[model samples]
Target: MRQMGRTNRARYLATFLLGYALSGLLTGTWTSVETLMDYFKYKPRILCVESKTKPYFAICPFHKEEDLLVSGSIRDTGIWDSDLTHLLKVALSLYKEAMLVDLGAFIGYFTLYAGALHHDVLAVEPSNSSFKRLRQGLLLNDFSATIKILNKAVSNKRSYVHMGKNQKLNLGKMHVNSEKDTDDRENALKNEMIETVTMNDLLEYIHVKQAIIKIDIEGYECKAMEMSTAFFKEVFVPFIFMEWLIIRTNMNSNETACTWTDAKRLVDYLTGLGYTPFAYHPVFTLLDPSAVLDWEIDNIFWQHKNAKSLLPYINLLRKVGPKYFDKMDQNQV
Candidate 1:
């Protein structure tokens, strides 16, 4: 009996040790596989395996499939900016055959699409790296002549300004407070001395009577709006889609932290501009519009007051499109 007991104990110990070793090996293998998949998922690939069928598919440098051009190019490395493609679609719907200005044109994804639709677009991007990608995309998509690609940042004043990190890629921060002063960095790499043009300047240069403007400048949206105030008064940009978010980031010398601007200021500005704010997702806002909703980070379609005539199109958009409605119900309330 004693001999049998000893043998069983030895077998049990060996089995336990074997199981532990197997678990470690399996875990390591799993981790390696996941890492490999992730690396390939974001690596830039040829979006076009076949030319004719893949016109719309460009390998996303960020997403690995040229499915939707997220940032300035496929070379960008960051989380996807969900609003870029959707906003482009919305703008295209409104200005199918009109002239448009794409302020902060990162990789020219929107510019290329707008130009493809045969709409004259003034694609303005401030980042040299991002602009290079934009230029490549325009050429690859054959939109060089269609789009007037400008490598400059638009601001209230025409002078040199600093370009921030990630190169026009959406840092996911909402509303740059034009009213509030941010920390000035003399050593930031993304800084540039591009020509700052106002809406008036754009009109003077482009010689257009009306336009559809899409503004997506990291957090300097309010500044852009302030600069465009004159143009808004003079010209007839009936449709304007601006990025309004509540961004949390380190500011004031990367030491201070704050929740940038709440959506109210931009909404108020739009309201003041005689544009009615349309919430992107109504279902989320239907629950409580006053409460901060996160279903749609980007709120769009602040049309001029007289542009209410376009409600049918708006309604159609909400019905058949990817936008969230009831978003602006709180503004009404």
Candidate 2:
């Protein structure tokens, strides 16, 4: 009986291995064929891909495979990066004529969306590859004359800075002062130094009467706020969309991440400038001034005191449900 049991187990193991090998081979064959098809479909030059937000393109000569995958995913799949589509539609509708300022505007997703809506747009991007793609996307959509593109990192200081070392996977990861002390200097990724500018510097060139700003500069929100306080005081920016990433973690060090203290300071600074903080989870949920001190979330929208008239629009967005925002592809210009 023991001999018979051993024979059954060996047969089962052999069968499992055979099935695994066959499945792997089939998958490899399918992937190769699909990749070849994609190369032919989008070869010679990167093609403009349409998302719910707007049409855009991405290209990285050094990381051609990954770049093509990213661009193709956006083109072929309608479901790529649709999280903010709904919210942006509602927000853009509220202020049709407001200037849209897209900081860290990688590949010009928001910039193109605003331009398509016929709103004057100012887009700032640091990485060389991303900026090139941003320009391509703008021109592809025939929005080059409508939207202004600046290839500079937005930071507290107007000086040149190096991109982070691990940006080979996605150029979007590139940011100012991204090198870690522990990173091996000899083997580290070498990125070109890009020019840096402040929000105030860009504001001088904007001729728009009203403005809305969207900031997603990795973990440099605090530094940006510190630099743009004067601009906030002088300008009546109705809405400010920024990422708030100050949550409690088990990590031993807080040096690399934005802390609760940084969030509180930013909230205080913005509030002092007469802007109210609210959570932007695809719907406009009002946030108490002190709530941001401890609350953990990614996107926060701040409304200026002068823009109290926008409350009705916010309420309308709340009643429309999240689905209403996704069906806005038809609203694209």
On TM-score, the leading prediction is 2
User: What TM-score does model 1 achieve against the real structure?
Assistant: 0.58
Instruction: Put down candidate 1 lDDT per residue, 1-333, tens digits, no spaces.
Output: 011134433443344344434545765523234432332332223121111111232211322232234532333422233344444444555545556788877655556656655667887777665575565455344454557777776666655554433423343222223333333434332443345555556766465666788777765555566656667766677777665442212222232222224333545666677766555543312212233334254445566766424455445554665334213121221
Q: Any idea what lDDT model 1 has?
A: 0.49
Q: What is candidate 2's CA lDDT for residue 221?
A: 72
Candidate 2: the clashing residue pairs are: none
Q: Evaluate model 2: give its TM-score.
A: 0.70
Give stretches of model 2 more than 4 Å off.
1-42, 53-73, 79-83, 167-170, 178-191, 246-254, 257-259, 282-284, 291-293, 308-333
